[model samples]
Target: MATDALKNVRIRIERAAQKLGSKIVPDWMLEELVEPEERFSISINVKIPNPLNPLEKIPKKFKAVRVWHRKPDPADIWKGGLRYHPDVTLSDMEAHAIEMSFKSWIMQLPHGGAKGGIAINPYEWSKDTLEDVTLQFAKRAIKRGIMSPRIDVMAPDVGSTKIIMDWLRDYYIDYTGDNIIGDGVVTGKSVGKGGILGRESATGLGMHMALQTFCEAGEICLPKKKTAIVQGFGNVGSNFCKLAGEYNISVIGITDQFGGVYCPTGLDIDKLINFASANKYKTINGSEVISPTYMKASFDELIAAGADMFVPAAMEETITTSVAPKMNFKVVLEGANGPTLADADNILIQRGIQVIPDIYANSGGVTVSYFEWARNTRKFHTNPGILIPDNDETSVKTALQVMFKKNGNALIKVAKKYKIPYREAGYALAIERVAPDIKARNRMD
Candidate 1:
């Protein structure tokens, strides 16, 4: 008997297909999409031992879960993010890993999908204690042979940062005595520490590219001053707004966890960014700030604000069925994973609101992570004296633009040929790419 959660996932999948006016996808594909090849639960003690109580050697234990969606290929490469959220669960990890696999396939990366994360709010831990927790987790994973440069590479995700990624890499290097391939073991590090340039802005850049491609394909001429409303103000949202400004897309309304700011004329993204930077990147209160033109608004008000584009960059399932009908944007660009629920997708399609699916829109991070991994691996294999050209912001940006255009064009082509929604078209294309490998490995029924 399927659990209620499993049943809900299946219903969502079926609803997605129905929205596209297509039958449910293959059973094998559906099975592989939800099941993990391997799962791991790790428990580590974060507290120090007390000499007074010798019997209490083990302190408070922090739990974590890791999942690999499929066995690594011949090169033994698997890639994913290491999130650190209080609500991290085994089921969530599995679902996220599966989506990573789809994302990798859509981007045509050779690596399989994997995810690992500790279930703790990093804000509660001191810097030193957080480092210790990260080190213990890495040690356990490395001991199990599930984490390495050529095996499983990890990047930052929700509640994780470049600082934490640097810690993971440094700890691994210290453990392995400065191994040659150490840098490739983790990505999203500071550029000075062997991280690639433009990695920080990759996801947002990808979102910009996705929206551009979507507009061009639909023959919808964007306004002279493109307008947008963003639902999240975190790294992804802020960076996305930055890129949008560069592309002439003025963000008129923006929201965070607390509240939002809206302006008909448009908010100065750079000034807003500076203000948020000074205030710990919290919610932007227009009234409290120097800008009287900006008014405080609710998240729903921001979403419903008329704009050229609607971007949900925060959490999943934010656009529910009821919320979908109220959205008044030319298109919805998914900057976060599963931002729109399947039921909402049907409503959006009926309303002629196109959605550039998360798998296609938010793939920039992983794509650039692949670039960093390749660069590191190349450097590791080459002679130290040989100077391999390092990738810069321009090169990374150009490569991402090319990829976004290519994939976006392919997705539009599929959608037209099959007469399906863009989301379904993306899934079909990704499944087509991954199905052959699964069949070759004799995983098909």
Candidate 2:
């Protein structure tokens, strides 16, 4: 099955290269692209002794897998996220790790790609139970020499949160006998736990920056009152909406897993944020903020509501071939990894809708993670009065602009030179950056 998946990915890469009218890919590049350096799977068993029934201890078993698509350089700077989902498998981890490799390369970060997650329904586990399981997993990973600040940095992903990251950090520190660099071993921690200031909203801000840069390069004028439809009001989606005002983009429609709300005149982002904050970030329901103007909508309805831009910040493969043709937005900026499947790329291209690839569009989180990791490695304690500058909103925004400008320009150059969709062009550019590194290290020879 893994071989078949790799073959399929290679076929897509070949097709994309052909469409670009570029030179044929070297055999070594194809080989490196289709294989990962390492894959590890571990089984974690956590015993939760029932207080009511002291005689019986329930043992929950979780299957976890981590994949390093490309090993870190000598300095050992590698990055990825850890998710807790019931359906996660080794194959999924390997594929996502490969995507992370491309994402990091596109951003020009000095890190390779790695990803791991456990097959457990986080919603079903008690907070204490979850922490125990996470600690157990961290212990096993550290014993295997795969979890550390310079080796493999873990962050939050779906079904995971900052609290879980804090637990991971604590467990790692315990195991390492209070290593000073332990805090850097896991990112996405709460501000009180050594996390960077602007790390939370980095991805959303990055998306906005990508949109603005893409528009300027295309000579497309954003509507004076620019409106957007965001699918998924999770961390990325909500933060995007929260910071939309910076770019003069108003979110007219937003959705969660349960349902959606739409207002033609634009819903109040602050009000929606307050409502979600008060209600566990669920759908906006029938609140007065959504009163007469806001109407409940479906996923399909919201996507086709004819907004100026559509941001799919939700799950992967959401924008499939069937849905791509019906999408009415002028532009589609992916805020989630692989939100649009491979086959859907041509369909959206035929409709003349530009897509900002996730590799470049949703890289804000990793960029900020890099910043946090850098802070951890710096010698801030050398002088008592010296303080490390905080990564505020303005600094994050500026850093993202620089990153977006460089990569966005590369996206355009590759797309125009190869005459392919932006997604394929991004893949080509990222591969160009990464493949050479592997060659330089003589790993692909």
Candidate 3:
């Protein structure tokens, strides 16, 4: 039986389609819409001679072993995240790959998704050992014709960071002797190394954008000036809080794996960042710290913590049936992919809470990755990048204002005509241009 999570995803997609007035695409139509490139043929083969190898300590973390897969996806090229955590499994990666396809389609990016992860915790391995294991995995995957810059792009995920990415990049370069995006093989690279201008803050920026958009649309004035409760203080959650502060959004509660801390008078992001940086995964709560109340809080309790918006930036399946009933927020923005389960989505929607789907919400990272690739491919040229010049934004604003005046609410009319989510509308505009090229490649005419 399909797990409740998967079922929920399908149900939400259907509901979203209905909301947009899009026809429930029959399987045959879906097959036709699925270009040949849409199917991915992956050949994943890895051999671990020692089942008991201390390094091969992943089987116990997940249910079974000998992970491998081959899937048919559009774009012919596969790209996705690779995570290492105690609960990693092949099926987990498969699901992520499916989301990547949908996400790339949503973002209008010409790519597909596939993810891989080992269940062993990184904390258990020394830096050198981790490097060796990563390189070995890379070599094995590469030799088997599985991973490559052109064939499949890989990025850091849970329990993995830029350091591991750097090591993998160097090892690939040494083996291939060809420049693979010159430190662009992996996204999320440190700033000095061709990483984009705001890469680290991209996820948070997307979350803020979602929250801001929701507030504007719903006209929900926060009780006390855009206050929020963030469940995970990892990269996405912490940076989100920090950037939210820049927008004058107050962050009240934050939790890390260890525990959470709260303060009504917004926590100091700089101090928390500095403390976490120094303490190596430890969370701080101002000068006066106490153990977190979040660890024991039900998922509903966590979201219903009297905040304007709740961000589940942590793990998947955290917001399931049992927890969705308790959420009291006006908006639930998912900073992490698939953070909310399918069943929970219906409940939240029925409650009239605007739940920002992951496809659009977390796309900033991939969008920036596309930027980094473009930069490297162009040899890091002096030309302007994705950053919209002030003049351009002003020009666009002026153009829209002029159009609105001439055709009074023309934008709204167009929006209603399309009957699409604003995010999907943005994507449709972009994909209309890219889809032609994708089609042209297979044209016999």
lDDT of 2 by residue, 255-290 (tens): 767788888888888788778767743556544444
In candidate 3, stretches whose alpha carbon ends up further than 4 angstroms from where it belongs are 14-26, 29-76, 180-182, 214-224, 280-301, 379-445
State the lDDT of candidate 1 residue by residue for 1-445, as single tens digits: 5433333344544544444332234655566566778989979887755569855644777898898886424554888999888877777777677778778877777778888789988777668668888999999998998878888999999889999999989888888876777899899999877899999989999998887887777634667788899988777898999888678888899887777889988888888787776664355655336487888889788776779889999876788878998989987888987777766778888888878889899999998888888788774333232222348888788878878888888888877877878777777677666666666566453
lDDT of 3 by residue, 1-445 (tens): 4444444444544443344432333333233332222222232233333446755533111221122222233434566666867776545555565566656555445565556675557776567556656776777767866666666667767677767777767777788786646465666666565555665666677666544554454433554467777777777787787888667788776765565666666677777777776664445533234334223333344466757778878777777787777877777777777787766666776787766667666765665555555454453333232332121224323322232222212222333566654333432333332344434543411
Model 1 spans with C-alpha error above 4 angstroms: 1-26, 48-58, 71-76, 219-221, 285-288, 379-390, 443-445
Scored by Cα lDDT, where does model 3 land? Answer: 0.56
Better of 2 and 3 by lDDT: 2
Instruction: Tell me the deviation in Å of residue 289 in model 1.
Output: 1.6
Question: TM-score for all predictions?
Answer: 0.89, 0.90, 0.74
Query: Cα lDDT of all candidates, in order?
Result: 0.78, 0.78, 0.56
Question: RMSD in angstroms, all models?
Answer: 4.5, 4.0, 6.8
Tell me the lDDT of candidate 1: 0.78
Off by over 4 Å in 2: 2-12, 15-24, 49-56, 72-74, 279-290, 379-390, 443-445
